[model samples]
Structures are given as C-alpha cells and as structure tokens.
Target chain A: LAKTTQPISMDSYEGQEVNITCSHNNIATNDYITWYQQFPSQGPRFIIQGYKTKVTNEVASLFIPADRKSSTLSLPRVSLSDTAVYYCLVGVPSNDYKLSFGAGTTVTVRA
Target chain B: SAVISQKPSRDICQRGTSLTIQCQVDSQVTMMFWYRQQPGQSLTLIATANQGSEATYESGFVIDKFPISRPNLTFSTLTVSNMSPEDSSIYLCSVEDGARGTQYFGPGTRLLVL
Candidate 1:
C-alpha cells in the first residue's frame, strides 16, 4: 500500500474553492488516486478518482501530475454542507487489495 | 455504486460482552471488508471476509477478538468479543465496486462499551 500524506485541517468559506493536496511518494504503477469525503456519523463518500492528469466529476476534480507522486482534490464553490473529512487513498482495485486510511484532512466550510 | 447497510446502527454494550454487526449489500460483491474507527481517529482495516475461506485479519486484529463470517457474496457479519471501553468506536463494512475502482461503505455500527 502507498502511504499518503495530507493536511490535517483546512478552512474555507462558502462560495470559495477548496483544494487539498495529498502526497504519495511510493505510489505504484498500478495504483490509482482516489478521494473520499466523510461527513459526521456517515460513511465516506467517493468524490473523485484518477490515474493521471485530470479527471472531473460533478462534485470535484482530481489532478495528478505525470510523476503520480502527489494529487489534488479541488472542490469548486464550497458550502457549509461540504464540511467533512476527506481521505486520499492510493491502491489497486483488486479484490485482495486492502484499503488503508490515514488521518484525513478535515475541511471545515464556514459561512 | 453498491448500497450497503448495517444492523444495530448504534448499541451500548456491557464490557466483556459480545456484539455482532451485520452488513448487507444490495448486489453481489467479490470483496467485503470490515473496519474500525475510533472516536476522532482514522479508519483501521480489521479484516477481509472471504466468501468460502476463513477471513484474513490485519496485524493488530485477530479472529478471536473480531470474528468475521462471509456466508455469501452480499452479506457478512462481524462479532466483537470480550469488549472493553477501548473498543467503543464505529464499526463499518464496505464492498468493493470493481467496475468503478472504489469501495462503498455502510452507515456503520456505533458501539459504546460500558
């Protein structure tokens, strides 16, 4: 499993964009960059995933450089409801591949 | 995305007792996992529930403490035995969405050991 490093916390106001970067220096060639958003008392929700370059979805966008050492999750026009812990995970999507989560970046969206 | 659900959404159990959490998925999945999340802490992988074989546990977790059962592809159960206050946390189960290359998790079973 590739170890990921991300910020512990980030603060953002409504209507502003929030970007969270994650570093996975040991990422493998088969690994994919995935981000999950977890709200209080709920399971983590899949936000975006990408193997390289950029991938955009309705909720967020993922940008992975060519090196794949790091990636960023960009949330455009955030709102208070977006306040939650975001986890970045890098691994293959195999059946035996275990998903390990680190201390996620807690994004607090304020008014 | 698979719809996952867990039984006993929240429970208060006495120390030394055991509680079994059930996880159900809307569709058949090849891989099912159990995880523990301590209060204000990150998620920890407990084990991988294999359909026909014994579950594979992580380094810090054991079958004696966290017994797992995957009778079929869409359902599994986890039993927390001889619980302690330190075991008070949220237990969750997830199913792998191989097509999407991600996992969908259940609402999680909140356990409070007293």
Candidate 2:
C-alpha cells in the first residue's frame, strides 16, 4: 500500500471549482488512484479513479501526471451539499479487497 | 455499484456488552470488508471477510474483539465485543465491484457505548 498525503481541510464557495490534490511519492506501477467522498454519518462513496492521465465521469474528474507521484480530483461548480471528507487511496487491483483510508481532506463548501 | 445495507443502524450499548452488526449486499460478492470510523476520524479497515473462512483482521484489531462471519456471498456480520466509550463509532460494510475494482459501502451502523 502506498501512503498518501493530502490537505487536512479546504474551503470553497458555491459555484466555484474545487480541486484537491493527493501525493503518493512511492506509488507503484500497478497502483491506481481512487477517490471517495464521504458525508457525515455515512459511508464513503466512490467518486472517480484513474491510473494515469485524466479520467472524467458524471461526478468528478481525476488527473494523474506521467510521474504518477500525485493526482488531483476536480469537482465542477461545487454546491453546499458537496461538503464532505474526500479520501484518496492508492492500491493495486489484486488488493482491491483491502483499502486503507487516511484522515482525508475535509472540504467545507460555504455559500 | 452494489447496494449494501446494515442492521441495527444505530445502537446505545452498555460497557462490557456486545453488539452484532449485520451487512447484506444485493448481489453475491467474493469479498466483504468491515470498517470503523471514530468520531472526527477517517475510516479504518478492521478486517476482510471472505466466505467460508476466518476473516483476516488488520493490525490493532483481533478476532476476539471484532469477530466477523461471512457465511455466504451476500451477507456478513461483525460483533463488537466488550464495548467501551472508545468503541463508539460508525461501522460500515463494503463490497467490491469486481469489474471496476471499486467498493460500495453500506449506510453503516452507529454504535454509542455509554
């Protein structure tokens, strides 16, 4: 498992774009970057995942550079409801059965 | 994504007592996971529940403290034994989406030990 470091907290305003970055300096070739969003009192939800370059979905986008040492999660036009803890995880496909979550970055979306 | 659910969504237990949390997935899964989230803390993997075998627990967690059972593919249970104030947290169950390697979580069981 690759240890990840991310901002402890971030504040963003409604309608503004929010980007959160995670660094996994020792990331392995087989590891993939996956991001999850967790609301208070609920389990974390899958947001987006990527191995390299950029991947976008209905909810968010993930950008991974060639180095794969870091990745960014971009949320478009954020809303107050988007406030939650976002976790960045790096692991291999075979280890999909196990996941380690860090403290995560707590995004506070204010009006 | 998998639709997961848990039993006894919330509970208040006395010290030294035990509580059992059940997790059910809409479809069969080869692997299931149990996680704990303490107040103001991130989710921590407690163990991996595999069907027909003893669950593999993570460091700092043990079978006696957090007993797990995966009798079938879609259902599993985690019993929090000898509860204490520190054990008060949200317990979540998850299953992997084999195709994408993503995990879907249940609503979670909130346990408050008094």
Candidate 3:
C-alpha cells in the first residue's frame, strides 16, 4: 500500500475554491488515485478518481501529474455543507481488496 | 451508489459483552467490507466478507474477536466479541459495485463500551 501525506486541516470560505493535495511518492503503476469525502456520522463518499492527467466530474475534479507521485482534488465554490474529512487513497484496481486509510484532511468550509 | 443500512445505529454496551451489527444492501454487490473508525482517527479495514466461506481478516484482527458472516450477496454481519472500552468505535459496512472501482458505505454503527 502506498502511504499518503496530507494537511491535517484546511479552511476555506464559502464561494471560494479549495484544493487539497496528497503525496504518494511510492505509488505503483497499476495504482489509481481515489478521493473520498466523509461527513460526521456518515461513511466516506466517493468524490473523484483518476489514473492520470485530469478527470472532472459533477462533484469535483482530480488532477494527476505524469509522474503519478501526487494528485490534487479541487472543489470549486465550496460551501459550509462541504465541511468534512477528505481521504486520498492509491490502490491497484484489481487488488484493492482493502483500503489503508491515514488521517484524512479535514476541510472546514465557512461562511 | 448503493443504499446501505445498519441496525442499531448507536449502542452502549458493557464490557465483556458482544454486539452483532447487521448490514443490508439495497442491491446485490460483489464485495462487502467491514471497517472500524476510532474517535479522532481514520478508518481501518477489519475484514472482507466472503459469501459461503470464511472471511479474510486483516492484521491484528482475528476471527474470534471480529467474526464476519456474509450469508448472501445482499447481507452481512459483524460480531465484536469480548468488547472492551478500547473496542468502542464506529463500525461501518461498505459494498463495492465493481462498476467503477467505487465503494459505498453504510451509515455506520456507533458503539460505546463501558
């Protein structure tokens, strides 16, 4: 498993764009970078996933560089409801039987 | 995304007791997983439930302490035996759709042991 490093917490104002970056220097070739958002008393929700380059969805966008050493999750116009812990995981698709989680970045979107 | 539900959303148990958390998925899934999240900490994978066979446990987690049962594709149960205050945490059940490498999770069962 590729260990990830991220900020312990981040603060963003409403209507502002917030970007959280994760470092996975030991990522493997078959690994895909996935991001999840977890709210209080709730399970982590899939926000975005990408193998390389940029992948955009209705909820968020994932940017991965060619080296695959790191990735960034960009949330445009964040709101108070977006306050939650965001986890970044790297795993081989077929071999992703278990996800090793680290202390996720807790993003607090304020007014 | 699948709709998953767990019984007894929250419970308080006495030490040496056991609690079995039930997980039900709205649709059949190929893989089901159990996780434990300690307060102020991240989630930890407990085991992977396999239908009709023994579950695969992770390091530091034994079947005797965390027994898992996947009776079918749509339901599974996790029994936390010999509970202690250290065992107090939120237990979550997740399902993999096998569609886009995404896993959906349940609301989670909050357990407090005294």
lDDT per residue for candidate 2 within B1-114, as digits (tens), equals 789999999999999999999999999999999999988998899999989989999999999999999999999999999999999999999998787787999999999999
TM-score of 2: 0.98
lDDT of 3 at A75: 97
Residue A41 local lDDT, model 1: 99
Collision pairs in model 3? none
* Deviating ranges (above 4 Å) for candidate 2: none
Candidate 1 residue lDDT tens string, B51-113? 999999999999999999999999999999999999999999998878766889999999999
Measured on C-alpha atoms, candidate 3 has an lDDT of: 0.93
The Cα RMSD across the true interface for model 1 is 1.5
For residue B44, model 1's alpha carbon misses the true position, in angstroms, by 0.4
TM of each candidate vs. truth: 0.97, 0.98, 0.98
Which has the higher lDDT value, candidate number 2 or candidate number 3? 2
Count of backbone collisions in candidate 2: 0
With a 3 Å backbone cut-off (N, CA, C), the pairs that clash in candidate 1 are none
Q: Is the docking of candidate 1 incorrect, acceptable, medium or high quality?
A: medium
lDDT of each: 0.94, 0.94, 0.93
Query: Candidate 1 — which residues are off by over 4 angstroms?
Result: none
Residue B92: error of model 2 in Å? 0.7
